[model samples]
Target: MRVKDKIHKLKILRVKAAKAMHADLQHELNAMHVYCHLRGFIGDRDALAFARKWERNIIYSHIIYRSINRSSNA
Candidate 1:
């Protein structure tokens, strides 16, 4: 799915979580983090691809942050 779509869905999920009496706030917070990370990923993906093609110029791509992608990687 697209990053925007994922972000929209996460936002909706957060709203639902907020309305739930037994919802864990941490879960909503984590979802928001993921949503932001996806946005960053969408932003940085282009630059990262360019950097990787040019002999690994960038030491780090904060857009494709490790903390964000770790779960997907696992």
Candidate 2:
């Protein structure tokens, strides 16, 4: 294939990979939220906030998880 065609194919593949990763992350966040809510570690409002903020920052995600775990343990 020509160089231009190869570049186009790479771009398409990258887009598809990004979309798949996004879907996986969203699924993970949803599962975490549901688990926390069902286990009574957090209420509905806080679970929604956790799911929303989890996507924005990894450090914040860890903090939230630790807090929830600590609260549950206590």
TM-score of each: 0.34, 0.30
Report the poorest 10 consecutive residues by lDDT, candidate 1. 54-63
Clash count, one per candidate: 0, 0
Residue-level lDDT of model 1, residues 14-70, one tens digit each, is 445445534444554555546456556436665334323321211122223445567
* Cα lDDT computed for each candidate against the true fold: 0.46, 0.49
Q: Cα RMSD (Å) between model 1 and the true structure?
A: 14.4
> What residue runs in model 2 are displaced by over 4 Å at the alpha carbon?
22-74
lDDT (0-100) at residue 73 of candidate 1? Answer: 85
Model 1, TM vs. native: 0.34
**lDDT of candidate 2?**
0.49
Tell me the spans in candidate 1 whose CA falls farther than 4 Å from its real position.
Answer: 27-74
